[model samples]
Target chain A: MSQKQEPRRKPGRPKAGTDQPDARDAILDQAEFCFAAAGFAGASLRDIATRAGVNQALLRYYFGSKQDLFDAVFRRRGGMISGRRHVLLDRALAEAEPTVETLVRAYLRPQWEMKQSGPGGAAFIALQARVHAEPEAHALDLRREVYDPSLKRYIDALSGLLPAIPRDLVATRMAFLVGAYLFMLNDLGRLADLSEGQIREIPPDDMLEQLVRFLSAGLLAPAI
Target chain B: MSQKQEPRRKPGRPKAGTDQPDARDAILDQAEFCFAAAGFAGASLRDIATRAGVNQALLRYYFGSKQDLFDAVFRRRGGMISGRRHVLLDRALAEAEPTVETLVRAYLRPQWEMKQSGPGGAAFIALQARVHAEPEAHALDLRREVYDPSLKRYIDALSGLLPAIPRDLVATRMAFLVGAYLFMLNDLGRLADLSEGQIREIPPDDMLEQLVRFLSAGLLAPAI
Candidate 1:
């Protein structure tokens, strides 16, 4: 191997500010698909490299390792989604009285907007769903750092809104809300077979409306 | 290789019967874990064989191919769960004036029972969630055959109960219900991290009760 191709660099510091913006985006895009489809353990750097049309060395030059690449792919999209959610939640909390419906909309509306953010947005949603559903904490460190804070805020906001509901119940409902939203938005198309043609016919906004409606009801429901 | 070890078999058919029940069960159990963790494309027979404490050839000898083995693992638990769901729904239908609570309980109670059906049961729930969330039709054939029938039954029953709710809305709610239930039942512990000890305290029965209560509300909530 030539020294030019495989330049030894410090670990954890990928060559920053790429001259070729598309190259970096291309690598991340392919990595997103791979990691979404196969997962962190299942996805291989070689496959991602080949798909991105970059050599393995170049791939590592851009991203230190597979784990780092996975983190990069996660962060590229996670920052956008979580950042938007934080803003929405902040706006809702500033209101004098934030109802569960408003909070639910704040938490869920970004997912609908993400559906319009093109393939990268959808891929990120799928990747998030996979990582969220993962049993092992493969992506736990990043998740805790990047996303959990926003979730905690929402959980706290909802807990205060529904004092009649137990605090634990708020957290549980939040988990359920996220679980249902991610599943519905990410793999909701798979339900086409189940719905014959009905699920496919509903517009994205309508789908989000129904999801918000369902989640709000569950959140506001009285304990038996 | 000796005839006993390297038995030439057809691609689709493994040996008719297994002399060792434990080995087969062990193989299915390990396969369930690997497939759930890594997915079909990501999981390898070698890893499964190693985990099962069996040789790769012996593993193939029993299950034909990795796909066949995946199918076996899926069917082993899926059939039981779907079958029990069918029976429960049947019993609920037989009851006089089966309320939404009755139907919801019938649909969800089995999942709690499944939690006690050993590791295989838990693994199956995770596997089902993985397969359900998967967008690709990797194992769509089996899923369609095993799951859609019971889901249709539940949807129809729910539609009847909520005559005011649109049929398509019932389908959407069913999707959300399954998504939430599967996530809650399968990886509910993952939330303990998010809840920071609050979610950890809820007893399993209370958890199920909360789930049932939440789902019942969502199912019965008036469409806006």
Candidate 2:
């Protein structure tokens, strides 16, 4: 929770020559931490500003309001993850025949990689899981805007592979896949405790393989 | 969020014989709602008291502290769900050979029935999902205490069925099954949106069937 090390400026004012990009990034990062720790309704602008070593006025200037700031935090990482998903999907489709496993891997790997990338990425993973629990007013638009199109692409690709399964069932299973992956991403030591340290350390690649295999089987299950 | 009406009393005082059990149940219900909407760090005792139509002092008198109240909320429904799971498991094991589907259904149906039971049950489902996203200090003990024993029973049963899969891998897939079921439990309109009205309404029984099928396939997948 340490603030960035730099010379302090007036609390409400951003100097014209200051690195505005750094300030904005810092605000989003701290906002993600706060929003993830306490949910959207619980996180305060003052707390986020203080954690970022900036002032509330600067946050307002950069992001307009708390809601706007939340949307920004989501868009910053949600957009990036969605973008990566599309790229992965493109390469998978271009490289070889897209089996359910290939499509599942393509959809899941980007988020897995992002979660392992750094603290900020991990915070976003937690925040994304929290988003599903949020009230519709707060979460619906953000979800539709940030994730729907990319998710639709994956769902369609999955449908293409499982032609016997209805598209709606495919969509339903896609939602299940998301739940499984998000839980694994923010497991918070459940696996270690559950396994009693027997499987304490799973390499990221192997973990991803397990997820893909489980989900691929699920997505390919016969329609009932 | 309307408070239940019987008769208004002094804000800070509980009547000597005014249905103490009812008051305690009311407090647990509203507390579940608040904690589900706001994370443990974000939910306030004052808000919960107000929502329950009691005062903060009564909450303190009954539950000791906010953490204690949270644990109570979890234990109330969590204990019930786990209890139901054990019953189902017993019946499954005695009535027939415990196939993966039967074990999966035994583990999953209790929570599904609870979610479909009433608003109080649904609130607890949301609260349970939010529990995983909570910090370790808030979530760890409750999860281990309320859920681990029943979950371990199911994991062992599944391992007994799938002798080829390692026990730790079985544990990991159990975690995945939890995530999938929880997400499906609190889908929050994602399925309708994802399906674009094509599958707007699914019967609860059918939804549970789909979940059981998906997870059975996942849990029974060949070890990677």
Candidate 3:
């Protein structure tokens, strides 16, 4: 997790004098871990700085406040996840005959891939789940800025595909989908306990396929 | 949010000399509010004590520890929710021809009703969501004790209803259903933001019906 060593500087330390991108990334990485492990209020900035191997001043220099640091951690991966979703959504929509399954897959695949990306990816997934559980005042702005656009696009596509359902109902179910995906993303071992060792670990592909199938059926359910 | 007044005691205060159930209930109430707002680690024992109009000693006397208090708060409502689910489930099973929708409604209705019960109900919903997002060590035991039995019953019932699907897959989908319900229970205002006021507040009955439709379809989807 440390960058290359520099002459006259310790390992995990960026250049002391100027603001370096490596230092910024390190802080975000550690911040993500801390926030994922503990929530926003529970996570300590000083601890994040220590884990990142930078001083508190450097953390402040890079990110103004604890809230700013939290936002930065979210924005870094939140943007990437949303961007990938858009790319996948565009590709799916461009298909010769886009089905609800294809669109659902497109919406879910990016997050599935992100969870599989690496430790950083996994940490971000946990952090994102925590953000959803966070109080509205703390999470609302970041969610609106980062996730709402791509989510709206998916909601629109799903509505178009299921014309029988009211658009508002579609929107509500989309929220349900978001909830299911986020919960499944980091189930916190509930699945294992609930299944009682009957289902230990599902292969990533199968899990994604299962989710798409379930949600597609859900989206196409006859409107009430 | 306070109990009845007592002679020579403050309004929020309980009988000081004894371990009154009222004092215990008050502690749990305030603890639920604090934990819901600030999370387990971030919630201060001091604040909870002050809010409940008892000293820290009384909290420790009744609950023994902070973790104990958290568990008690969860168990208080978790047992009620799970017990109500069982009653509904049993009723559905007793029906002459219970459909997938009926079973789904049975499982979800308790939680929906709990969310509407009052402020305490709302706070428990929030706390439950936070518990799912909490670190596993902190939440796992409480969840297993309070929720797993009813969840397992639902999984078995669903598997019996959809015999072609793998039992494990049914369990997985049940987890998905749980995720969707918890998320929609207190969506952290996501639906409002996503719908952009096209849908303001969904009437409770409509919301439950919509959830039943979505989840029933999701659960009955063909096994992958």
Error of 3 at B181 (Å): 0.4
Q: Single out the weakest 10-residue window by summed lDDT for candidate 1 chain A.
A: A5-14
Give the alpha carbon lDDT tens digit for every residue of B32-91 in model 1: 988877777768889998898777888888889877898899888788878999999999
| DockQ order of candidates, top first | 2, 3, 1
Ten residues in sequence with the least summed lDDT for candidate 1 chain B: B7-16
> How do the predictions measure up, each by TM-score?
0.88, 0.91, 0.90
For residues A56-140, write the lDDT of model 3, one tens digit per residue: 7888888898989989999999999999999998998998889999988898888888888999999899889888887767686
Candidate 3 residue-wise lDDT at B202: 73
Q: RMSD in angstroms, all models?
A: 5.7, 3.9, 5.1
Chain B TM (all candidates): 0.84, 0.88, 0.88
* Candidate 2 positional error at A162, Å: 1.1
Q: Write the per-residue lDDT of candidate 2 for residues B1-224, one digit (tens) a residue.
A: 77878676755556677766677878988999888877676688889988887777889889998889989999999999999999999999997566899989889889988988898888889889888766455576788889999988888888889999988889989999988888888883557878765655666678788988998999889997
Give per-residue CA lDDT, model 3, range B1-224, as digits (tens): 68866654444644558666586789999999999988888899999998998778889989998988999999999999999999999999999988888988999888888888999999999999988877667686787788889999988888889999887888889888988999998883457667755655677678878988999999988876
Instruction: Extract clashing residue pairs from model 3.
Output: none
Query: Model 1 captures what fraction of native contacts?
Result: 0.53
Candidate that beats the other on TM-score, 1 or 2, i.e. the better one:
2
* DockQ score, prediction 1: 0.52
* lDDT winner: 3
